[model samples]
Target: MNGVVPHIVQYQGSKRNLAPQILQYMPRKFNRLIEPFAGMAAITIAVAKQNRAKKYIVNDLNEPLIRILNEAIETPDLLIDSYSKVWNEQFLYPEGSVAHFYKVREDFNKGNKCAANMLYLLARCVKGSVRYSSNGMFNQSPDKRRNGTSPKNVASNVSRISSFLKGHVEFMSKDYREVLQIAKPGDIIYMDPPYQGVCTKRDSRYFSGIVFSEFVEAIEKLNQKGIDYIISYDGSCGEKQYGTDLPEHLGLQKILLKAGFSSQSILLGKKELTYEALYISRNLQDSIHFQNTQLSIFDSL
Candidate 1:
C-alpha cells in the first residue's frame, strides 16, 4: 500500500469507508481495474493508491459526473482555479449563498458544463445527493450547512485526485453493461450499481432503469469467461433491510461488513447500524484467504 489515500468528492451512497475492506478480496495483480457505476469513485481512488493494476477504467451512467472526473484528471489546475474563483466571489455572501447556489444550478441546467459547477453543486447540495427533475434540471436543494468545502481544501483535493489519476485512469460515460463487456480474463471489475428497491426515483433521472435480473445475467457472463469480480449492494441496515435479496442459485459468496446509518435512515429518525454486502464470484473466492476465521467479523452467506 502507498499509504496515500486521496480524498474523494462528497457523494451519496459512497463506499469510502468500506474501501479498505473491499480491497482485501481483489486479485493481487491484474491487467486492468474496471469500475461500473463509479459514484465519486471512492473505491477506485482508494485502489489506485495501492497501484495494483497496470491500467484503470471508471465508467458511470451519469454523463456530467463523468465529465467532471475526466476534467479533474486532465486539467485539474484549471478546474481548481475556476472553483476557487466561484468560491471566493459567490460563497462569501452568507445571506445570498442560497440564491447564488440556485443560480449556478440554473446555469448548469442551461448547458454550462464544467467541473467547477458540478463540484460546487455536489459540495453544497443536500447530503451530496444528485437528483434531477422531470425536465432534466438539477433539483436537489442547497444544504443549509456551511458553504461547502473551502477553496483551499477543494483545490488540494482536486490536485491529489488528479495526481493519482495522472496516467493510468480513463474516465467514461457509458452504461455499466457496456463497460463491463470490455473486461477480459486478467481484468477485475468492481460493481457498485444502484441498489434495487432504493433510489428508484433518483436513478431514473441519470440512467436507464436497472433490472436486477439483467444485471445478474451480465455477471454470469463474466463468470463464464473467467473474469474476476466483486459487487457492493444493500444488505441489512439495522432491523430494516434496504436492498433486494440475491438469488440463491447465483452461488455467490456473500460477506457482510458493518456500515454506518445511511442518509435515508437518518432522515427517517432511525439510528441503527447498517451492513454492506460484498458478493464475490466463485473463481475469485480463493484469492482472499482469511487466516483467523474465528476472529474475523465477516459473515459467510
Candidate 2:
C-alpha cells in the first residue's frame, strides 16, 4: 500500500470512506483499472496510491467534472494557482462566503469550465453535491460552513494526485456504457453508480439518466465478455432498506459493507447507519479471500 490515499474533490455519494474496504475485495493482479461511474474517482485514486494497475481509465457523464479531473492530472500547477486565488479570497470573509461561491459557480455555468472554478464549487456547495437545474445550470447553494477547504490543503492534494496520475491515467467524459464497452478480459472495472431508490428526480439531474434495466444488460455483457467487476449500490440507510433488486439468476456474489452513518442522513437530522452492497462478479471472486470478519461477503442474503 502507498501509506495514505490522495484526496480528491468532494462528491455526493462518493465512496471515499469505503474505498479501503472496497480495495480489499479487488483482485491482487489486473492489467488495468477502469471506473465507469467515476464520481470523484474515489476508488481509482485510492487504488492508484498502491500502484495496483498498470493503467487507469475513469469516465463520468458530467463533462465539467471530468474536465476538472483531467486538468488536475495534466496541469497541477495551473489548477493549484487558480484554486489558491479563489480560496485565499473567500477564506477572508467567512460570513459572506456565499457571495464568492455564487460568483465562481456563475462562471462555471457560463462555460468558463476550469478546474479551479469546479473545485471551488465542489468544496463550497451544499453537501458536496453537483446538482443542476432543468436548464442545465449549476444550482447547488453554499454549505454555510466557516469557510471552504484551505488553499494549502487543496494545493497539496492536487500535487499528490498529479504525481500519482503522472503517466498512467486516462480521463473520459462519456456515458458509462461507452466506457464499459472498452473493458477487456484482464481489466477490473469498479462501478459506483447513483443509488436507485435514494437519488430523487431532482437529484438525478446531476448526471445522465440511468435506465436500470439497460444498466443490468450492460453488466450481463461484461459477464459474457469475462470482465471482472465490483459494483457498489444502495443497501440500507438508517431504517430504510433501499436498493435495486438484482436478478437471482445472475450468479453474482453479495458483500454487505457497513458504511457507518451517512453524511446525507446527518444533514437531514437523522443518524442513520449506511450499508452498501458490493456485488462481485464470479471471475474475480476466487482470487480474493477476506481474513477480516468485517470484510467478508455472505454467500446467502
Candidate 3:
C-alpha cells in the first residue's frame, strides 16, 4: 500500500503479494510482530514498512534460508558481494547455467553453506520455488531462463530492507513452538506455516514438517493466553484445494482473500482463481480496530 516495500528475495510460499491485504487485518501499530515460519519474512517486511510494530522476530527451520535472510538484514555488503560472485561464477562453467546450478547445489549439500549460495539458488530456482529431497537436501532445479537478480538490484533491495528492520528485528532458527511460547499478550504473531498437503509428511518444502494436531494445539494455547494472531493456513484454487481447514472448535473467524490466479497453475496451463484463507484468532476479529478486515479483504485483490 505504501510504495513497494523492499524484500530480500521472491520466496516460494511467501505471502509477498498478499501482504498488503493481510496487513489490513492487523492493527496499525503494536509492540512486536513475530513470524514463526518466516520464509523470506514477507509479512514482517510489510509490517515494518507500515511501521506497524516496534519489534519483529523472524524465525524459520531452514538454516541456510535463515542465514541468507540474516545477511540481507544484518550484513548487506557481504551478501551482495558474495552473491555477485556466486552469480557471475555461473557463466564460467563449461556446461553453462544448468551445470553451475547443480554444482552449487552439490556444494551446499556437501556442507559448503553460505548466504550467497542460498540466495542465488532461491532466485534461479524454477518458479522461485524450492524442493527438498526426503534425505534433507536442496534438489530444486534451476529456472534456466534467467541467471537471477543482478548485484546492483540486490544491493538496493538489501539496503532498503535493512533500513526498515536492521535494528528492530531479531532472527531465530528455532521451533515455531518456542517462539509461540515467548510471545506475550501485547504482541502479535503472524503465522504462515507450511500448508498441510504438500508441506507435510514426507513431502515437505521445509527442512521439517509441522504436525497438524500440534499446530492446532499451539494456536489453541494462544487463544487461552489472549494473544492476537493471524494465520495463513489453507485455501483452494478453483476446484483444487491445498490443505485441511482449521478446527471449528478453535473458534477462529475465517476470511477468504481472493489472491487471483495461481502462478503455478498458470504454468500448468490452468488459469484458476486462488483464494487464500486467513484465520483470525477469536479476540482479534472481535477487536473494534480489526472488525472491518473481512469487509476490506477484497480491496487489494
- What CA root-mean-square deviation does each model show from the true structure? 3.1, 3.2, 2.3
Worst 10 residues of 3 by lDDT: 288-297
lDDT per prediction? 0.77, 0.79, 0.85
TM-score list, all predictions: 0.89, 0.89, 0.93
lDDT tens digits, residue span 38-91, model 2: 877888888877778889998988877787788788888887788888777775
Of 1 and 2, the candidate ranking higher by lDDT: 2
How far off is residue 192 in model 1, in Å? 0.6
Q: What ordering of candidates by TM-score runs from best to worst? A: 3, 2, 1
Candidate 2 accuracy as TM-score: 0.89
Cα displacement (Å) at residue 292, model 1: 7.6
lDDT tens digits by residue: candidate 1, 1-301: 2464656467877888778778888866678889988877888788777777888898987777887777777788787788777666565666588888888888899998677888888888887888877666788999977788787877777777777777888888888888988899888899888778644444533444477888888887888888889888777866677676677666677777777666677888987667888888877776655432421234432
The order by descending lDDT is 3, 2, 1
Task: Using lDDT, give the best candidate's number.
Answer: 3
